[model samples]
Target chain A: MSKRLLFVFAALIIATMVLSACGPKASTYECTDAIGCVTVAPGDPIHLAYDMVINGPDATLGIDSRNGVEIAIAEKGQLLGHDVQLTGEDDGCSAEGGQASGTKLAADTTIVAVFGTSCSSAARVAVPLLSQAGFVIISASNTAPDLTKAGDPNNWPGYLRTAHNDTIQGAAAAQFAVDFLKVTKAATIHDGSLYAESLANQFAKVFQELGGTITAQEAVDPNQTDFKSVLTSLAPGGPELIYYPIFVKAGSLITRQAKETTGLENTSLMGADGMFSPDVTAGAGDAVEGLFVSSPDTSSFSQKYNDYFLPKYQELFGSEPVSIFHAHAYDATWMVMNAIEAVAVKDADGTLHIPRQALRDAMYATKDFQGLTGVLTCGPTGDCANPKIAVYEYHAGEYPPIKVWP
Target chain B: MLRTWRQRITIADVVVWIIGLSIAFVVVYGSIKTIEVGKYNTRVWIDLTITGLALGGVYALIALGYTIVYGVLKMINFAHSEIFMSGPFTAVFLALALYKNGFWNSHPYISLLLVTLLAVTVSSTLAVLLERIAYRPLRTAPRLVPLITAIGASFFLQYAFRGFFGSGLQAYPELGFLKGTWTFGSIPVYKTQVVVIISALIMMLILYGFVQLTKMGKAMRAVSEDKEVAGLMGIDVDRIIMLTFALGGASAGLGGILYILLFPVVHFFMGFIPGLKAFTAAVLGGIGNVPGAFLGAMILGILEAVGPSLFLDGMGIAAPYQLKDAIAFIILVFILIIRPSGILGERITQTKA
Candidate 1:
C-alpha cells in the first residue's frame, strides 16, 4: 500500500509539471517586406509597450483597451519582416509612477512604440521623455486638451491619441445640457485634479457660451467623502443642472448626496467620460438612474471588439475584455506597425534599414486611416481629429447612448 | 565646566539647529502667507479646517491603535494598518448583505450599528490571532525579525484581501441616517464630520479612563514598564499584551468604518498611507502616549488639508493635491530630526541614579 501511494504521488507531480508547461505561450506577429527584386528574410522582433493604471484588476476600461491592442497586434502579422512583441506596465494612473515607467521605456532600445496611459496625468509624465527618444506614443483614452495642443511646443511633439480631448467632450456635454435637457442655469464641480478641473472648466466655459448662466463653481478634495456643504450651497439656487467631471469614486458620492439634499429628482445631473462606467452605476445605485454622461459610445465598440478578439483574449487571459481603452490600445499597435511598414527599406545585403525617427514622422503623416474608434488623421499637433462624442444616460442600470453629438 | 560648554556650541549642533530652524521658518511663513491671502475668503478657511478636523478624527483613532500596541509590545505592529483596512471591507460586505436582505434599507441605523460591532469584533479577534501566530514565536527573536515579519504580514493581508475582494474599489451604500449638514454661522459642517469627531472624542475619553482607572490598565502599565518584572509581580504579562492588541485593533476597526462612511470608496491597499500617517502621528505624539498621538494626528490632518491652500497657495502653486503622502513623510522626518523622543517622550534614566 505504501509503495502504491508513493507511485501515485510521483505520477501526480509529473502530470502537474506537464500541464503547467502547456500554458499559453506569448503570441507573435511578423510583417515582411519584399524589395523590387528580392524577398527579405524576417528581421528582429518589433517591440510595442502599453502603460496604464486601471482602478483595479476588475476594471473593464483597462481590459477593453488592452484587448484592442491585442487585436491590432494579431492583425498586423509582423513589422519589417520581424515578429511583433508587446509588453505592458501598470502606472496606477499617477504622475510619479508614469514618469518612472516612461523613463524606463525610453531607456529600452527594443521598444519602438507605446500605446497607453488612459489617464491624462500619466501622459503628462510620459509624452516628454518618449517624444525626445523619438518613440511614437499613442494614447487610447488620454483626453487632456493641453497635451495635444501645440500651446507648449517644447513639451509635446510625438504624442498622439485617438480619443477626443476634453475641449470637444466638454462642449458636447454643455450642448446636451442646453439643448436636450433645456437647462438655462448650471453649476460645475471638480476634484481639483488636472483632468477633472480642466474638463469642468471647459464645460463651464462652453455652457456659458451657449447662453447658460453659471450659478456656481466648486472644487472638492478627491479623498473627501462628504459634499453636503457644497451641495447645500448649490441646493438653494436649485440650478437646473449640476455638471460633475470627476472619477467614479467621488462622482458616485456627489450624485447620491446631491439627490438626497437638493431633492433634485428633476434637476438633471451631468457627468463626463470619467463617470462613464458600470462601477459608477453600482456605486451610486438608484441615484444614477437619470444621470447623463458624454463620451465615446462603447455599446457598438464592445460588440465589434468581442467579435474579433474575444476568443484570443479568453484563450490567453481566461477572461473577456472590458473598457473602451483596450480597443484604442489595439488600434494604436496597428497604427505603429503601419507607420513602420511605410518607412522600412530592405538593402542589397539582405538587411532592413528602418530609421525609427522616419517611422515616427510617418506616424504623424498618417491620413484618413480608419481605426477601431473612428476615422483617424494625425493633425499637425499629433491629435487625432475624431469628432465623435456620444451622450449616455443611465437607464435600467446600464449606460445607453442617448445622442451622438456632431 | 557647564557654562563653558554652553557658550561654545559644537559645529554639529549649529548645523542641526540651522536645518531645524530653516524648516520651521519655511512651514510657518508658508502657512501664514496662505492664510493671509485667503483672509478675504473666510469660507475657504472654514471649509478647509472642517474637512481637516473630520479626517483628523479618523487619523487619531488609527494612531491610538498604534500607540497602544507599541506601549505594551515595544514592537511596531506593521499589520495594524491592514487591520484598519479590513474593517471597511468587512463593514461594506456586511452592509451589502444586510441591504440585500431588506434589513439595511429599512433600518439604516440598526444596520450601521450592527456592522460597526461586527467590524470591531472581527478586527480585534484577528489582531490577537495575528500576534499569536506571526509574532509570539519571534517574541524572543532578534527585534528586527519580528519587525520584518510584521511588514510581511501586512503585505500578506493586503494581497490576500485583494485576491478575495477583487481589486476594484467597492463603494459603500449611502446611509440616509448619516446624511445631511449642520450650518454653524456661515460655515457648513457635515453630519459625518460631527459624528466622526464626537465618536473619536468619546472613544478617546473611554480609553483614557481605562488606562488610568481600571485594574487591567494598571497591569498594562506594569507590563509596559518592565514585562519580566510585571510577570514576577503576579501580572499575566502575556494576557495584558493580547488585551493591548485587541483594544488597539478595536479602535482601528472603528476608524475604518468612519473612513468608509466619509469616503465611500474602499480598496485592498487603502490602509497603506493611512497606516503610515497613523504611525507618524503615534511617533509625533510620543509613541505610547495616547494624548500625544491624538494631538499629532490633529496637527498632521490640518497640515494635509490646509497646508497647500494656506502655505503654497500664495506662490501660485496649485497644490498637487495628491502629494498628501509627501507632506506626511516630510513632517515625519522633521519630527524625527528635531525631537526624536517625540513631543512628550520620557527622558532616558541614568544608571548611576
Candidate 2:
C-alpha cells in the first residue's frame, strides 16, 4: 500500500511539473530546438550583434542607431574585462530582411545579446528568432506596441526596448490636432505596415474619443506614388486635418498632392516620426512647409549628447546624425553593457563566465538607470523608457524642425 | 435557361462565366450600395468624372506608344513604359534650372514649351536608341526572344536612369498660373487638370494627324501590314520601324510631363503603373487600334476614379481606397474575359493581315 502510494505521489509530481511547463509564463531558460543558449568562456570576447536598416529608403534610422552603439562601445572600452565585438547586420527595415538577419544572427551561438532594429517591422521577425536562441534583444527605436508586448502573439520574452511605444505618440498627436489645432474633423491614413497602421489607428481612436469626428480612415499601398484620387475621394467629407503617418516617399507625395488637390488645400497636413527627416523636406520641397510632425521629445535629451556627442559624431562620421533614435540607441547599448557587467562572473584564472539567462534577468531588473534620453526603469514587459512625445512644425528649407509642443 | 447556357458552354467558357459572374456580382453589389449612400451627390460625381478624364488623357497618350509598337512588331513592347518614364525624369532638371534662373516665372509659356520640346526630343532619341540596341538585334530571333529582351531592356533603363539621377523624389516647380482652381459654374476644375487635359488633347490630335496624313506614317502602316512585301516594294522597313518608335516615344515623354504636372512629383519608378495602365488601355481598346486605345483609356480612368466610392462606399466598406488597384485590375480581367480581342475586336489586326 505504501509502495502504491509512492508511485501515485511520483505520478502526481510528474504531472504537476509538466503542467507548470505548459503554463502561461513565457519560456525563459528552456533550450528550444530552434535556438539554444549561448555561454561565454574565459578569454573569449563577448559578442554583441546589431540588426538594423543599413540601406534602402529608411537607412537614416538605422545609421543613427549604429553610430550610437559604436559610441557606447567606445565609452565602455571592454565588457567584464574581456574584449567586446559587435557584428552588424542589415535588417533592410522589412520583414524578409529581419527574418534573414535574425536567421543569420541565431546561427551564431557566440553572440550574447543584440541591440537593434530601428524599425518595428524588422524587430517583429528578429525578436522571436533571438528569443528562441535564448539571446536578449534590446531595441533603441522600435515603437510598434506589439514588438515587446503580449498583444502581438509573436512577442518573445527576450525582447526589450528603450523606445517609447506608439500609444503615447499617437495619443499626443490626436491631442495636438484636437486641443491645440482645435480641429474637430480629422482623417487618418496609414501605409498598412504594423508601425504605420497601428499609429494611425491609435490616433483615430483617441481623436474620436476626444469628441472629434473621424471624417475618414484610409490606407495606401506603400508603392503608390499618386494620392490625388484618394485625397479627392475624401475631400467632400471636408476633413479639417489629414494625418498621414507613413514613410518619406509616400508622405512627401501625399503632402505635395494634398496642397495641389482642389478641396484639400486648406486642410492641415500632419505626419508621424516616420516622416521626420531631411528626406521629407528634400522630397516635398516647398510643399512640406507648415507641416506638423509628431516625434520623440528632443527637449528631454541630455545636453551631453548635444555638447559632446554631436561634435564627436560629426568629427568621426563627417556629417550630422541623419535622424532621431541616436540617443535612444546610446541608452540601449549602455543598458546592455551594464546588465552584462552585473551578471558577469570573473574567476582568478583570468576567465570570465557570462550566462545568457542571468544576463537577460539583469537587463529586466534594470531600474533607475540614468541614461541620456531619460531615467529608464525597465517594466515587467520590457518597456524601459517613460512616454515623452513632442510635435514639431517644419518651415521651408529648414534643417532642424521647430518644436511646437511640450 | 441555366441548362441551355450550360449545354452551350465548354470548360473554358464555363471558367470564364464563373469569373465574369463573380466580378459582375461584386461591381453590381458595390454600385448599388454606393448609389444608396446619400453622401455622394452630383457635384461629387462631376468632380470624379473630371479627375478620371484627366487621368485617362495621359493613359491614352502612353497607350498610343504601345499600339504603334504592337502594330509594327506584333509583339508587346513591355519596355515602352520605361521609355515614357525617361522623358519626365530628365525634364525635371530643365524645369529646376529654369525655375532657378527665374526664366520659369518670367516666360512661363516659352519655358513650358521649351521643356516639352526637350522631353519629346530626348524621348524620341532614346526610343530610336532602344530600337538600335535592344530590339533590332533580336528581331530575327523567336517571338519570345524579343519579348524577353524588351523586359530586360526595361529594367536596365530604369536602374540606369536611377544611377544617373539619384533615386530621391523630385517635385516639379509649382507654376504660379497652375496654382489655383478654375471654377466653371458651381463646378471647380483644378488649373493643373485643365492643363493636363488640354495639352494631352492637342498632342493626341497632332499624333492622329501625323499617322493619318504623313508620308512616314504611310510607310509605318505598310511595314506593319507586310514587312517582307513592303521591303520588296522599296519601303525602308527598318527606317519606318524606328520612326514608329520615335513617334511613340515622343508621345510617351509628353504624357510623362503631363502626369508630373497633374501630380507634381517625379521619381524613376513613376512610369511603371502609368505604363501598365496604358498597356491595359491599349489591350482594352484593341492593341493595334489607335482610336480604340483612346476610348479604352477614358473608360478605364473613369472606372478607376469613381468605382471605389460609387461601388464600395455605400456598402459600408472600410478604407475603400486601399482596393483601388484591385478595382483597376478587376476591370482589366473583365475586359479580357468578355472581349479578348478588345472593344474594336480583331478588326484592326485583320486590316493588317
Candidate 3:
C-alpha cells in the first residue's frame, strides 16, 4: 500500500467513471436544409424507430404495420452500405403514451426517421415533439383530415401519413348512400371522439349538400352500453340510414340495438374504418350482416407485392394479417429508406452521412414513386399518398368484407 | 350600511358567493337553452323521465349498500363497489352458459332467477370475506386505516378480476322478454326499465321492513347507537356487524343484475363509476339514512339521465351527454355546501346525540 500504488488505484477509478459516463461522440455535420442539422457518419447504422400502438385492443392494426415495415427493411439489404436497424415503442393508442414514446425516441440523435403512429389521437401528441427535433415521421395508418391537411394545422411540418384522410372516407360513404343506395334521409351519430365526431360531421354535411335530408345529429356516451333510449328517441325521426363512425364496443352495441329497437328495426346501418374489423362483426353477431363500412381501398395493392407480401408475412409472423394498412406501412417504410439513400453522403471508405433536414426534404419531394399500395406522390402539404375510399358490406359468415362499392 | 356589508363579507365569503353565483348562472342558462332546443316532444320527454326513474331505481339499490355499511361501521366501504362488480362479472359466465344451452331464451324468467341468485351468493360471500380479512384486523385502528385498506382491497379485486377474466368488455346475454318496449298510450316504457324500477322499489321496501322489524335488525340499530353499550346489553355486536355487511352485499348484488338488465355490457371497470355514483347518492341522502339514500339516488339518477340534454343542451353546449358524470358531482358539491347533514342524516344524529 504505497502512495504511488494508491494514486494509481485512484486514477483507475476516475478513468472507469469517465468512460462509463461518456456516450456516442458528437460529430460536426455540414448544414443545408431549413429545419436544422443532424449528423450520421460512415459505418453508422441508419436508425429508425416505430412509435405505434403495439398492444391493447388495436394491437392488430399496429402489428400489421410493423410487419410491413420489417418486410420493406428486408427488401433493402442496407442503406448506402450501412446496415438498417429498426426499434419500436408502443404509444398504447393514448395521448400521454404518445408524448412519452416520442420524447424517448427524440432523445436519441442518431435516429434519422420515424414510422408510425397507427392512430390519429396518438399522432396529435407525438407530431410536435418529433417535428421540433427535425425528424421526419411517415405514418401508415393515421387518417385524421387535420393531421396533414392544408395549413398543417397541428404544426407537424415533418409529418406525413400514407393513409387517406377520413374526409374521403366520409364523402365516399355519403355518395354511396345518396347516389347508389338512394336513401333520401340519414342520421349521423358520434361517440364524442375527434375521429368519430369529425367523420360524422363530415358525412352529415356532405349528405345534406347532396339533396339528402339529415333527420337528426346525435352524440352518445361511448361507455354506456344501453343505447335503447337513444335509439328509441331517434326512431320517431325514422331515418332511412344511420351513420355512426365509432369504434368496436360502442359500434357493436349500436348495430345490435339499432336492429332490436322498435323504430330503428328497418334503419340501414353504416360505419367507418373503425368498425371495419372482424372483432366488430363477432361482437355484433348477425346484426352486422348487412352493415356497410367505408375504408381505404385495401385490395388495390399490386398483385406481385400481394403475392409475395402475404406468404412472406405468414412465414415471418406465422399468421395472416389481422387488420388493414399493412401495404401503406410497407410503402411508407420504403419511402423513408429511399429518402435516406437519396440524401446520404457516402465516403470512399463506405461511411454514410445523413442530414436530418435533407431527409425530410427528400420525403416531401416524393413524386409518383411506385409503391405496393399504388402510385404515391407527395403533395405540398406532406400528405404523401393519395387516398382512395371503398365501401364493403359484411355478409353473415363472411371472413373478409365483401366489396360493394367502387 | 356599506361599512357593515363590507365587514360581513370576507374574501372567503366573496369567493364562495362567486362560485355560487356562477353555478346558478350556468344552471339557469343551460335550462333555458335545453327548453328552447328540446322541441317540446311530450312523448320523448316522458320516455326520458321513465328511463331516468328506472336508472334511479338501480342507483337506489346500490346506495342502500353504502348507507347500511356507513350506518353500522361509520367507515366508507370503498371495496363495496368491487362487491357489486363481483356478482355481475361472475354471473355473466352463468348467463353465457345458459345462453349456450338454449335455456336462457327458452325459460327466460327461471334463468334470470338463477342468475340473480348466483350474483347474490357471490356478492355476499365476497362481502363477508372482505370484512373478515381486510377490515377485521384493522377494526380498532384509526378510521383512515380501514378506509385506505378498503380502497386497496377494491383495486386488488378489480385487477384480480381483470387478470382472471381478461380485460375485454363482455355483453350481457340479451333477454328476449326485456327487449321490447311497453307502450302506455303515446309513451313507450322499455320492459327492462319497468322491471328495474319495480324490482328496486320492492327490494328497498323489503330492506326497510327488515331493518325495522327483524331481531337482527334491532341488534344492528343498538350496535350502531353505541357498540360498547350494545355489547354491555348482551347484543352480539360482531354478529350484527357481519349481518349488516351481508345485507348490504345482498342489495348490491340485486342492483348488479338489474343494472346489467338495463345496460348489458359488463367489464372489470364497470363497478368503479356506478359504485362511486351510488356513494354520491348515499352522501346526498345523508349517508347513514336508508330512505334518504333511496330518495337521493332517484333524484341523482333522473338528473344524470335528463340533466345533460334538458339542462346543458339548452345552453348551446355541444355534446352534453359526454358531461353526464360531471353533473352528479356538481349536485353533490352543491348539496354538501348547502346542507352538510344531507336530507335525512340530521335526524339520526340528533337521536344519537
Candidate 4:
C-alpha cells in the first residue's frame, strides 16, 4: 500500500509540472498557440498594444484620440484587477506607413488588438492584414460609410470604428444647410480624394434629399496653388453656401480664395472633420472667421485624459495634447485587453486555452462598455452607430463647439 | 543650316510631337465628354496659366540649386534635394517654436524674416560641410564615384531625418502675414503664390548677377569650363566649387521655407518628388545654363499646373489628379529622346585631329 501511494504521488507531481509548462505562467496571460481562444486568468497581467499615427501633419486630433485610449486603459487596470501594457505605432497618416505599422504589430504575437488608423485612407489598407491575422482593429475616427455597410460582401469581421459614418455627418450637414441656414442654392467642392469625395457625395445626396439645389459640383487637385478659375466657375447665380469636404492645406487656400472672389464673408462656408483644426483657422486667417465645421465632440473626455495621461504625455512630448487621435489610440489598447480577459480560460492544471475565433467574437459581444468616447457598443456590422457629433464655428481665432447632434 | 534644322526634326521628334498632340486632343475630348455626361452639375475649365506660374516658381527655385552645382562641379549633386527638404522641416519647427513662445504673435513678419535668415544660414553651412566631408574626398576620384556618393548622401539625410522626427506629417503654424487672396474676376490668387513667384524671381536675378558679373562668379565659370587649366592659373578650384554649392543650398533653403508657407505640410520624403522635378527643370533649361534653368522651371511648373484639367481630365480620365507626375515624366522622356542637348543646351562639336 505504501509503495502504491508513493507511485501515485510521484505521478501527480509530474503531471502538474507538465501542465504548468504548457500554459503561460500564472502571473501573466500569454497566448502561445492558435487552438482555443484564451482569456486572462484571474489576477494575471495582460499586455495590450494600440497602434496608430501619433505624429504627423494630419495628426491634430490623433493626439487627443490616443489620450482617450490611454485613459481607458489606465481605468481598466484599476477596475479589472489586471495589469496592462500599452504600446503605440506611428503610421505617419500615410497608407504605406499604415501597412508597415500593421505588419509590424501583426508579427508581434503579444499585440492582440489595434485601435487606430485615424484616417479612412490608412484604415482601408490596414484592415485586411490585421483581420486576416485574427487581431481586432477598432478605429476611433474612421467614418467612411462603405466600411460598415452590411450590403458589401467584403466587410471585415474584426474591423470596427467608434466614430459616426460620413453618411450621418453628411446628412447632418445637409440638414443644417437646408433647415437651419435655410440655404436654397449651394455649391460643393471636394479635393478629389477618396475621403473628400466620399464625404462630398454623401453631403450632396443628403442635400438633394432635403430639397436644396446643388448648383455646382467640382473637383480640385489638392497640390495646386491657384484655385481662382475653379472658384469663379463655381460662382453661378451666387450660391448661398459652399460645402467643402477637404483637408486643411487645400481647404485653407479655397477658403481664402472663396472669401476674396465670392464674398464668402457674406456667405456661410461649412466643412467636415478634416477642416476642424487650429491650422485651418491659422492658415485661412480671418477668411475662416465665420466658417462652421462639424466633428465628433471629444471635449467631454479632455479632463479624463488630462487627469490620467497629461503628465506622462507632457513629460515625454513636452506639449499639451492637440487632437483626439490620441484618445482613440488609448482606447484601442483597452479594447484588446478586454477581449483577452473575456475569452482566456485556464484549466485546473494551469494550462491556458485560447481560440482566435473566441477573441474575435468577444470583441463583437462588447456592449455598453464605457469608453473615453462615451458608452461603447459595437454593432453587428462593426460600427459604433449614433455617435454624438458637434458643430463648431470659428470665431475670435478659435473653434468653440456650439451644438451637439444625435 | 535651314535644311539641317528642318531635317533635325528626326523620327523621334515626330513621335514625340504626335504623342503630345494625341494626349492634348484626348484631354480636350474628355472635357467635352464630361460636360456632355452632366453627372456633375457644374463644368468649369480650371485655368492652367496661374497654376503653371506658381508651379514654375517652385521648379525654378529647385532648378537653380541643380544648375548652380552643375555649373561648378560638372557633376549632378543628387543630395541637393535632401538639403531643400531639410530647410522646410527646420523652418516649420523654428516657426512653430517661435509662435508658441509668443514671438510670432507679437511681430509676425520680423519673426518670419528671422526664421528665413536662420534657415538660409543653416542650409548654406550644411551644404558646404556636406561637400567638404562627402564630395571633396571623392573630388579626384572617378566621375561616377562622386555621383554615387551624392546618391548615398541623399538617402542618408532622408532616413536620418525620418528616424529623428519619427515619421509623421508636421503641420506648420500659419503666419498671419502670409494670409490673403488677390482675385481677378473669378480667378483667385493667394498671397503665398505671390510670395513664391516674387521670391523665386528675386533669387534667380541675384544668382544670375552673381555668376555673370562678380569676380568670384567669373572664377567659378572658368573653373567649370576647365578645372585643371583654371587650377594652373592660380584659381582655388575647390573653394569656388564650395561657394557654388553654398549659394545653391541657400536658394533651395529659401524655396523650402516658401513651400511650407504654401502647403504647411512637411515630411522627410518631401524633397524626393520636388527634387526630381527640379532636376527636370535643369535639363529642360539646359543644365549648365542659369537663365535657361529659370525659364525651364517656369514652363515645367505651368505644364504641371495646367496639364491635368486641360489635357488629362479633358480626356475622360476620372482622376487626372496624380496624372501630373506621369505627364511630367512623359515630357522628360520625350525631351531626352528627341532633344538630348535639351531646349537650350549648347551644341557639342567635334574637331578633326
Candidate 5:
C-alpha cells in the first residue's frame, strides 16, 4: 500500500502542476474580461498613464488636459480605495512620437488606463497599440471625427474622447459663417494634420450645403513658416471669409500673413480650437484683432468649472486654463475614475482586481455623466462630448476671446 | 564642354536630360498659361515679389553659414541648424523681458539692436562650442564618422535646449515701430519686410567686404583651397576653421532675428526646417561659393513664393499652393541637372583647377 500509492500520488501532483502551468487557474477569482484584467496587490497604487503632447507647439492643449487629470486625481483623493498614480510619455503631437510613446507604454502590463494622444495623427498610431495592449484609451483634445466614427478603420475598440468631434465643430463653424458673419464666399486652409484636414473639409462641405460658395481649400505644412504664397493663393477669389483650422504656430503665421495678402484686406479670418490660445495673440501681434476662432463653448461648462475647477487649476498650474480642452480632460479623468469605481473588484485584504475589458465596458456604458463640459453620454462608438461649439472674436493681446456666436 | 558632354552622354544621361527638358518645358508652359489666365493682379505679383525677396534675404544669410562652414571643413555640419536655433532661442527671453518692461516699444531700435547682438553672441559661441565638443575630436575619424556625429550632436543639442527651456513655443514681442507699411514713392512695402530686405543687403555687402578686404578672410580662403597646404604654409588651420564657424554662426543668428520678424513663434525644434532650406540654398548656390549662396537663396525664395501659381495654376491644379514644396524641389532638381556644380559652383572648381 505504501510505495505504489506514493508513486500514484506523485504522478497526480505532477499532472496538476502541468495543468496550472499551461492552462487557466481553477480556483482563483475567474476573470471574464474579453481582453484581460489587472490584478493589483494589496496597498498597490492604481496605475494610469498619459500619452499626450505635453511638450511641443501644442503643449497647452495637452498640458491643460494633464492638469485637469492631475486635479481630478487630487479631487478624487482615491480610486476604488487605492491611491491613483499618474505617469505619462509626451506624444510630441506627431505620428513618430505616437509610435515611440505607444510602443513604450504598451509594453507595461500594470497600466489600467491611458489618457492621451492629444492629436488625432498621434492617435492613428497609438490607439491600435494601446487597444491591443488591453488598455482603455481616452483623449481630452483629440477632435478628429474618424477616430470614433462607426465604420472608420481608425475607430478602434476601447478608444474614447471627451473632446468634441470636428464634425460638430466644423458644422458649427460653417453655421456661424452663414448665419452671423453673412459670408457667401468662403475659403479654407488646413495644415494637413488629420484634425485640421478633416475639420476644414467638414466646414467646406457644410458651408457649401448651406448655400455659401467655397472659393478655395488650401493646405500647408504644420512646421512651415512661409504662408505668403499660400495666403496669396487664397486671395485671388476675394472670398469674404477665410477659415483655417490649424494649430498654434501655423495658425498665427497664417493669421498674420493673410492680412498682408492683397485681396484679403477686408476679409474675415477664422481658425479652430487648435489655434485658440494666448499664444495666438502673442504670435500674431496686432494681426490677431477681429480674427475669429471656433472652440468648444467654455461658458457652457458646468458651474463647478468656474468656482472649483478654475481656482484649483490656478492653485495647481498657477495660470488660467491654458487651452480650451481642460474641462474635457477633467471630465475624461472623472469618467475613468467613475469606471474604475464601477468595475474594480475589492478583496478583503484591500487588494483591487480590475478586469481590463470590464473597465472599458464600464467607460462605454457612461451616460448623462454630468461633467464639467456638460452632460456627456458615451455611445457605442465611445464619443462622450456634449459638443457645443461657438465662434469668438479676438482682440489683440487678449487671452480669452470674446464669444461672438451662439 | 558641350562637345564633351555630348560625347560622354550615356543612355542614363540621355534619360536624365529628357526628364530635365520635360520639366523645364512644363514650367515654362505653365508659367505662360498662368499669365494668360491672370487671376492674380499686378498688385498681387508685386506683393509676392516683395515677400519672396525678404524671405530670400533671410535664406541667403542662413546659407552663408552652411557655405562658409562647408568651404572650410569639407564636411556638412548637420548640427548647424541647432546652432541657428540656440542664438534666437536664448535671446527670446531678453526680447520678452524688454517688451514686458515697455522698453521694446518706447526704445524699439535700441531694443532691436540689443536683441540682435545677444542672438549673434549666443549663436557664435554655440557654433564655436559645437566645433570644439562635437566636431574637433572626430576630425581625424572617417568622413562618415563626423557626419554621423553631427547628427547625434544635433539630437543632443535639441533635447538639451528642450530640457533647459521647456519645449513650449515662445513668442517674440513685435516692435511697434516695425508695424504697418512705409511708402516707397507710390508703392507700399511693410516696414518689417523692408527692414528684413535692406538689412540683408547691407549685411551681404559687409560680409563680402570682410571676405575680400580682410587678411583672416584670405587665410580662410587659403584653408578652404587646401587645408594641408595652408597648414604647411604656416596658417593656423584650426583657428581659421573656428573663425569660419563663428562667422557662419553670426550670420545665422542675424538670420534668425530676420526670420522671427516674419514668423514670431520660437521653439526648440524651429531650426530644422529653415536649416534644411538654408542647406539646400548652399547646395543650390554651389556649396563653397559665397555669392552663389546668396544667388541660390534669392532664386529659391522667388521660386517658392511665385512658382506654385505661375507653374501650376494654369495647369488647372486645385490649391496649387499645396504643391509649393513639390514645385520648389522640382525647379531645384532641374537647375542642378543643367548645372550640377550649382549656379555659382563653377568658381570653386575653376579656382581648384
Candidate 6:
C-alpha cells in the first residue's frame, strides 16, 4: 500500500475537524443528532416516502389518502428552499404487503419521513420497520388501538396517526345504536382483520355495557362472497341491528344478502368507516338504502376543509373525495412537513440536514395544531386525533350520507 | 372376508380408516345434535340449501373447465381461473352501459344474453390463447414445467386485466326482473338465485352432452386415453386439445356470470377464490370425470353453506361461519382418505407419466 494516500486521508480528516470547530460561521451544517441525518444537497428535492395500499379492493382508501398527500405536496411546492418530492411503494392493504413495503422503505436511507398504511393490518407489520429506520412515521387511516396502545407488542416508537382510535369510534357507534336507534338487541360481524376484529369487539363490549344485548358476535373472511348462511344463523338471535364494521366488499355483500335472508328481513344493518365508500352504494345496489355507517364526521372538520381545501382538491383531482380519510391524510402530511421545518438545519449553500430523532421529537410534541379533522394533539405513545365520530344514513344511489346521529 | 381384509390392510391403512371413521362419527353426531337443538327451522335449512345449490351450479361450471382440461392435457390449467375472470370482468363494462342507458331494466333478457355471450367469447378466446402461447411450447417438457407455466400465466392474466380495468371492484347491475321472489309452494326463492341455478344446469347439460355425445367429443376421449395412438389414427390432437380448453373456458365464463348473479360484485381478483374452490371441486369429484366434477361441486357448495351451522353449531363452536372454508377443506381431506381416487376419479394412467 501507499503511505502517501494514507497521509492524504488523515490530513483531510484533520482539516474537516478544524473546519467543523469553526462551524459557528453559519455557512456549514453540523449534524449532532443521536441517530443520523438525511442530507438534501443544493437543488435536490427533500424526499418523503409513503407506504400505502395503492391497489386492490381497498385501493380507494389508500389512493384517496395518497391524493391528499399529493395535494399537500402541490400546495407546498418548496420547503426551506428545496422541492418536496413524494415517492413511495404500495402496501396492498395486507400483512404481507406491509412486510414487503416495510422492508423496502426501511432499506432506503434517503427517506426523510413516511406516512401511510391505509389499513390497520398493513400498518401492524409495516410501522415497526419504518419506526426502527429512525423516520417519523404517521398513518392517515390506521385506527386499530393496538398500533397506538402504550407498550403493546404491535406498538412502536416514532409512530403516530391522525386517524381516531377505534375505542372512540366503536363506542360511539354502540351508544348511537342503543340510545338513538332504540335497538335492544344487536349483532356484530368482523372479517377477522385486525381493524374489523378489534372494532367489532369494542362495539360489542360497549353495547353490552350500555344495557344492550349482543345476540351474536361472528366473523367472516374478507374474501368470502356468501354471507347467506351467516345471516341465516344470526336470525335465531333476532338481532334488531347487525353492526358489521368490515370493509367494502364483504360489507356490501352482507348488506344485500341480509335483506334476502328469511328471518333477517327486518333486521337493521350498520357498518363502520371502513365500509363508508361510495362503492358500498354501487356494490349493494338498492339495499344500500337505509344503511347506517359510522365515520369521522366531516361537518366538524376545520372550515378551510370545505371553504378552500376541498375546492382546491376538486380542481386538482377532478372529483369528490372517494373515501373518508383524505382530510386525515392531508393533516398527516402537513404535520410531517411542519415537523421537518421545525427540526431541519439549512446551510447558506442551500443544502439541508434533517436530524431524524429531532424530527420524531417535533412530530410527537405537536399540540393544538390547526389542521383538517379538527385541532390535533399527539399523546406520548402516538394517538393524535381530535376524534369526532358520527353515524350517517345512506339512501339508495346517493352518497356522502346525511349525518343522522351525533 | 375379514381374513382377506386383514391380509390386505396395513397399519397405516387401519390408522387412516380409524381417523376417517372418527371424523365421520363427529359429523353425524354434530348433525344430529343440531337437529335436536332445533335452533333453526326447516325454512332456514331450505333457504341455505337453495343458496348452496345455486352457488354449486357456478362451481360445477368452473370445475368442468378444470376436469375437461385435465382429462385431455393431463395438466392442471391453473390459469383457468383467470379465463373465468376475463369473461365477466370484460362483460361488466357492457352490462354497465346497458344499465346506464336504462336498456337493462327495459330489456333484461337481452342484456343477460348479450353479457353472457360476451363473457363466453372472451373466456373461450383467452383459454385458447393461453393454450397456444403458454402450454403448447411446454407440452413436451417435464410435467412440472407446464404446471409452473400455468401459474405464471395466471398471474400474468390477472395483472394484465388489472392494468386494463384498474384494480377496483366493478359492480354488476341488478336486473329488475331478477328482483323479488318466486314462491315455490310455501318456500320463497329470489329470482336471481333461481336464474343462477337454471342457467348453471343448462350450461352443465350442454357441456356434458357436447363432450359425451358429439363426434369431436369421441375424438377428445380417444386423445385423452392415448395421445400418440389417437393422433396416428387420424385425430388432430392439437385442435382437439384447444377445443377442450375453449369448452372449459366457455363454461367457466358462463359460470362467472352466474357467480355475479349470486354475489353481484366483480373485480380483477374476483376469480381467485372461486377458481380455487372450483379446482378443489374438480379434484373432489374426480379430476377427469365431468359428472364427478358436478357432484363434487354440489357437495362442496352444500357443505360450505350448511356445514358450519349444522356441524359446528352443535359442537358449541362460536362464529362457525368463519370456519366454513375450513370445513370444506376438512371434508376434502376425509374424502381423499376414504377414497383417494375421488368419488369418480379414474386410476392414474400412463397419461400422468
Instruction: List chain B TM-scores, each candidate.
Output: 0.92, 0.94, 0.94, 0.87, 0.96, 0.95
Q: Return the lDDT, model 4, position B338.
A: 59
Residue A92 lDDT (model 1): 59
DockQ scores of the candidates: 0.14, 0.38, 0.23, 0.23, 0.63, 0.71
Model 1 reproduced share of reference interface contacts: 0.20
In CAPRI terms, model 5 is classed as: medium
**lDDT value for model 2:** 0.84
Q: What local lDDT score does residue A195 receive in model 3, on the 0 to 100 scale?
A: 73
Of candidates 5 and 1, the better by DockQ: 5
- How do the residues B1-353 of candidate 3 rate in per-residue lDDT, one tens digit apiece? 99999999899878876777777787788778767766536666676677678878888989999999899889899998899999999999999899899999999999999999999999988999999999988989999999999999999999999889876667666788777778777666678888999999899889888888998888888888888999999998888888889989999999999998876767787888788888989999999889888988988888776776677766766656667778767867766767789988898888788
Interface RMSD of each: 5.7, 2.0, 3.2, 6.0, 1.4, 1.0
Stretch of 10 with least lDDT, candidate 6 chain A? A21-30
CAPRI-style grade of the A/B interface in model 2: acceptable
Clashing residue pairs in candidate 5 are none
C-alpha RMSD of each candidate structure in angstroms: 10.4, 7.8, 4.8, 7.2, 3.7, 3.2
Candidate 1 lDDT at A67 equals 68
